[model samples]
Target: MSIKSTKIFNSKQGMLIEGNSLELLESDENLSDLKGKVNLIITSPPFPLNQKKKYGNEKGEEYKNWFTKLAPIFSELLADDGSLVIEIGNAWEPERPVQSLLHLECLLGMVKHPDANLRLIQEFICYNPSKLPSPAQWVTVNRLRTVDSYTHVWWIAKNDFPKADNSKVLRPYSKSMEQLLKRQSYNSGKRPSEHQISEGGFLKDNGGSIAHNFFEMEALDEKRDVRLPHSVLSFSNTNSNDYFLKTCREKGITPHPARMSGGLVNFFIQFLTDEGDLVLDPFSGSNTTGYCAEKLNRKWVSFEIKEDYIEQACIRFSDPILKSPLKKMKA
Candidate 1:
């Protein structure tokens, strides 16, 4: 089980390793002291899709069993009050309008693992409005369906409540909320849905209102896409000219097509972890999680099997990009 892994890049803030995560997680000598010590584990493992990806994936029932078998190993590595956030893409049964429930079943299997004892904290939908309509036969040719434009993000932990503070991820107060705050006194009465409204507290401002679960985030440019203080995370899978992509083009290596969105990665890292908290990403394709964690001043460890992708991911942490975590976080 001891597979050779090379640390492509390292700094005071973070590090990246090139290797199969499953093999490394089970028996990596370097990670022996890290067991039960990671504060946050955020990852997007290759989905159980029918389509071919350069990183490869498993599909159908086989995918579920394979993913479930890793649950116990993940559980053993998580500290109490630590969070495991996984992003899963949906799959469809071939040549049909029916959507496969493989993602849901996978979540259930992980939660029910004998040694995991993981709890479902919340399920957030990452809406990508610009995604092209898929399954050409069912959508374009037959004209029978709308595009599946959203994916699922499962926040899991060992306990009902993990180490999280809503205040840390509060959204900006809107105009309506500002108006309410201006009018300190409110008409207390039974409103819609037969719920009674209070007077004093309703008009008070508590920094900013918490964000809802279903988040809609979009932008063409990575610099424009800022992760506001929010519990939920979303990003368009449309960043084609990022640091990793540019490096891949320069080096003649095909970039990881299924890289996790940068905005998505930043949200969970900031919300679930503190400045010095340790983060781990098992299937760290292109090491987006590692890059973002470094920006936020969180210590991170990334593992990837693809040598080319891992090599390209290191470009994000080189000289100019990561001279300092504080500089990157501000940018």
Candidate 2:
């Protein structure tokens, strides 16, 4: 199906769209129109989890064909130095077994200019208990079953490396009680050195310190009373859509199911693109990417086929917490 390009929507610190991305890119528009433009493309495409839903197909052949047709345009839209991060999970069925990552690997291989197409920089695992079903064979064999813990997040870069600096987004470190006890050993008469003072001042004063990447960060900010989460997201079926609902209730707004936590999106924005760079989420779902991009001071465009999701996305973006960062950027 061909898509027609629509005018870019303009609004004050909120979600905007210009129609389906597939049709927009496939038009007679010049490729140069987007050349050296987009900084990052981060999206969690609807997993072909064989769920008999309107979003994906159950047949592997049909699934592969869909990705085959869609992957190339993404390559073309990517900036020479930009990165593409796609989150995919395994496809499972009792009767037939197939790995979705392998299909994605093959699809990516088929993109035009595989050499220039981008290297797989990293694979982030999105561990979810909800994605796993009770094991039929394992429960019978060992009286135990293991649930699937991780989904693949392929980080692809058109150039040799990502254009953004990642150290800025480093996970906070934790101080154990054992280490905390050692602080008393320091000389009481001695004043901290200038470098040590700045680095450890908060530590010296505050009773607790930041934890390492091993432990997840607090997903929500209680003081700010916002729903923004941390990079290492904790997925819960109950909390999946509750955050949006709460935010809406507080601000007199609505919710979107495809809406993801801002923490995950913020991590990608901080790690993948510099401020003011453009970010695109082709299969926008709830438009979480656009909301995150706005929060991180980046320009964003998203494409969602469903009008309901589009409206929800718009409402979510218009929330004060999401728009506050954008205002700071403009100032």
Candidate 3:
């Protein structure tokens, strides 16, 4: 209930709170004024799995109930046109080859919650092609299944078409498309689909192409990468040489193992929120959401149960990004 105990870091643009999110939301005075004020809520909460992870996870019915309880609070925290995006990984039955339906059940439970009027806007698959094969029995030893490469990212909101701009996160034109842009003409006609394409146009360049839900990136490095239509979100599963790791090693801090993809978060931040909008991540592991949100010039608040990861996420503030188009932050 006390504001002094939970407040950790308070900068000009953001603040980090250290405590249970339920308590912080229900009682902490410092965060009290923010009820129903956040423009974007992005988090990758611990998944429900047969095996427990060091980062923490619930399984089966417990996981469903736990996640469902938070839905109403999340709805209460969003502004009228705001959006909430959660990235939840899949789970497999213990020693079984088949995947668990807990994730899907949890999603349905949240959607059906009486107090939460959230709509399932879209589902994104964060394709991590480089992830190692799991369920050693089924995926490696018996070799019955392939590597588990993608996780589900639910983009939910009160409105089906919540505040979003495709133009904000468009990808660059491919070489073939660039040549066509110069020509300034397109052959438009109706064919196999039976839908007519008006013959007069298709000449204007709408900047870059509207990005598809699928996303992929080679690694954690921030250089812009090509996006393929088939992939919603893609990035290297584990990055060893990033500055965040370097800082953690120097400080003798163990990095959070299950971190959200940097590239994935960057796209949503640009697509969903404008500069100076507020972004909140209630289950922030290593607070990657906070780091990315602040970098994009948005006001942010992050709540983490672990003090160690919260401390480490602060290091991101001082790290330099090369060739960044983001507004320069004053020293």
Candidate 4:
């Protein structure tokens, strides 16, 4: 898990530096090199749950202390207008789960800079827990119960808002359906002739338009292998790792554990950032933020402590689908 031995290696699209982000950030050479250059900060730091998870095993006071020590450096590296999006969930204890939103709020408040403004944009929920255990209290008495589901995603910004392009992320309606609807127009006063209507088309001469916002995405088709996942994501635990397995089977791509869903990342990036912006992820667990940033044509820097995870990230970054366009763009 140590990153001391890591080094930056040139790749097809960009360079992948292998080192600790904090250590690198503290170095005069590194800070001088990247100061005032980053444009966005999208990361999911470890929840201070004090659980024996794969990532690390720091518990209670130790966990909070670690986070407090790490927050300032990330704040310093962020640009004046850059956005910092941090995703954290409630730390589940067998007895009680602790919500991290207040901790996150405090973190932001403490990290606020005089020159760079900061604000909480949204406290939206990421509803991923689909399966629920029967209600514990009800089951004990009446043999019936319900389990709660959902996580929180906090969007925080510094200085100005992140640049975003709405057009690129637009969802268009089906052309055929639009045509059919247009032909059956209900405008009696301005009704056009059948031939004129046919030629003019139903909705418009151009393709049908789509609604704005992220809630319009359709559900996944298990049979057809198509999933137009919504912004408020819901995934069954059974298929949680299905996409990664499918990619591995079809294209030899190994998925990262802390990888955030592409759909989720796309929504945030589209709403909070523009193309060619620099995104920063200080506690990059599996490089999901970096992956999405690259996909959206944004430059990124990630800090990961584990060497094995970094290697995995390097492999994922080398995937043809993700790497090819970046190569083309650079070329």
Worst 10 residues of 4 by lDDT: 225-234
Arranged by TM-score with the best first, the candidates are 3, 1, 2, 4
Alpha-carbon lDDT, every model:
0.77, 0.57, 0.77, 0.53
Error of 1 at 37 (Å): 0.2
Write one digit per residue (lDDT tens) for candidate 3, span 70-128: 88999989998999999998888776788888888889988889999998999987767
Where does candidate 2 stray beyond 4 Å? 1-8, 13-15, 28-32, 56-58, 97-116, 130-145, 176-243, 247-259, 324-331
Tens-digit lDDT track of model 4 for 1-331: 1123245533332344555666777763644556766666676666555346676635555665665565556556666666666666554333433233545544554355443345665565555433244234443545543453444566665544545444444444555555556675633334445433343344443332432332312333444322232332233323535433354446554444455555666666666667776777776655666766776677776667776666556555666676532121121
Return the lDDT, model 3, position 40: 94
RMSD per candidate (Å) reads 4.9, 8.2, 4.8, 8.0
Off by over 4 Å in 1: 1-3, 6-8, 219-236, 240-242, 246-253, 319-321, 324-331
> Which runs in model 4 stand beyond 4 Å of their true positions?
1-5, 69-71, 92-94, 97-117, 130-148, 165-168, 171-256, 323-331
Positional deviation of 148 in candidate 2, in angstroms?
A: 2.6
- In terms of lDDT, the best-performing candidate is 3
- Model 4 score (lDDT): 0.53
Worst 10 residues of 1 by lDDT: 322-331
| Candidate 4 clash pair list | 135-145, 135-146, 163-273, 163-274, 182-202
lDDT of 1 by residue, 83-190 (tens): 999998889886578889888889999999988879899998887766677766788889898887788999999888788876777877866667878877767888
Q: Where does candidate 3 clash, by residue pair?
A: 213-232, 214-231, 214-232, 215-231, 215-232, 215-233, 215-234, 216-234, 217-234
lDDT of 3 at 99: 88
Better of 2 and 3 by lDDT: 3
